[model samples]
Target: MNGAKVDVRKVAGEGVTWTLLATLYLRAWESRLPEPILGDRYAAGAVERIDYDFAALRRRIRPASNQFLVALRARQLDDWSRAFLARHPNAVVLQLGCGMDSRMLRLDPLGKLRWFDVDVPHVIELRRRIYPERGRYTMVGASVTDDGWLEAIPADRPVLVVAEGVLPYLTADEVRTLLARLTGHFTAGGELVFDASAPWVARVAEDFRWAPRDAREIERWIPGLTCADATPFTTHHRRIPVRRYRALYRLIHAVPALRNAYREFRFTF
Candidate 1:
């Protein structure tokens, strides 16, 4: 990975697309720390090269408050992805709403597994400018909700669908339809990993559309879907650098409802 040639502000602009930059910035900031969670050097390098109003964006989003938390979430997802690849070396991976995440780079060093990073056209274009194209790696420039993108991916192999900070932005119907399409298309059976907020959190965050109190609730929406694991950030509260945030997470983890309010979930079908 090298420095970005295009200006992210001109490409991604604001709104949902801009959130990708925020995450990239957070990962880069975390990587600079003495002890980092994700240790994404590619993200740090991209951040340094991309020309954008990062300071203004930071002030607007106030992303620093959840900096470590963001890195933790990414690290957890990466771990799950690595485990999936370890078990099924030839599995196909679909990284939905990939943004500018370097997950494929981090996990697929040997380029053994087929990997596809799915996102909108503009984001994909930006990614092209930043990252080098490699064998067994393809960038799909299409919305996750779009059906056409799936046609290009091979359905013969088991699929591992990974979505981080994506499902919340999609409507419940959209998510259900997308999952149904995926499960129906891939008969080999695979896993789905993503994070979701609680209903109350969704209500508070006006932009978010879908929230499930329980991961198993998804099984009702899509037949054959089983909740394998649901873990809250508080599960690793000890890793938090700030004492106050650690204490807060501890309290949140104590309550079943609160703990599940915001967490990552793994589902198998």
Candidate 2:
């Protein structure tokens, strides 16, 4: 896992594992840019710690489109979370299935909020080795779908749930159960930001990529959702600071597939 090249495919048995690698790759790529959309030094460090040829891995993952999209999606998520923190500085921020991402550091909540990075035991163990624990930040080693782990987080304050690239891995039922429990537990109400694919897109994604077997109908999953809206990845492209692709990105939005394939959502419960 150090300097020696290791097969990323074998190293990561789950989709989240590959997603984490892709994230690190995007962050590393951004770091080299003159004006990066996300200045994530931690992501660059994480990539170096993993023993693999990142360039070769990019080819394997189809870097031409995937890398740019990954970076764009991440920036969108970060923007929404930052806004939430601004409004509710004392809120509890729960990052479900947090996989080696240094979002907490990137946002720097500044001890105003209780930040919890929740993931499975194995990933948590790996994160413990890579990232240092900071004040007002706790890492919970448990599956996001498990309800018991939520107990560790205090429910007194408003909550902000950031579930980027997580809902797609969960089945429709699992998504339903998780959302219901979360809304129930946080009766005081909170905001949720997550990514979801359309049913048709989900079917195609499963055949060619890593997507849940059962597509999640997010709106139906949470009937009590206060404000649910689909935000296309391209919608946030113009907001990106990178000038290299600004013109090209604006032009591509005309293609429906490029605009709506993977949509993010912001909800209130």
Tens-digit per-residue lDDT, 175-233, candidate 1: 99999999998899899999899899899886799998677679998987998888886
lDDT of the structure predicted as candidate 2: 0.73
Among these predictions, the greatest lDDT belongs to: 1
The true-structure Cα RMSD of candidate 2 reads: 4.0
Q: What is the TM-score of each candidate against the true structure?
A: 0.93, 0.84
Off by over 4 Å in 2: 1-16, 53-55, 62-64, 109-112, 207-217, 239-248
Q: Please give the CA lDDT of all the candidate structures.
A: 0.84, 0.73
List of clashing residue pairs for candidate 2: none
Error of 2 at 134 (Å): 1.8
Clashes of 2: 0
Worst 10 residues of 1 by lDDT: 9-18
Cα error of candidate 1 at position 66, Å? 0.9
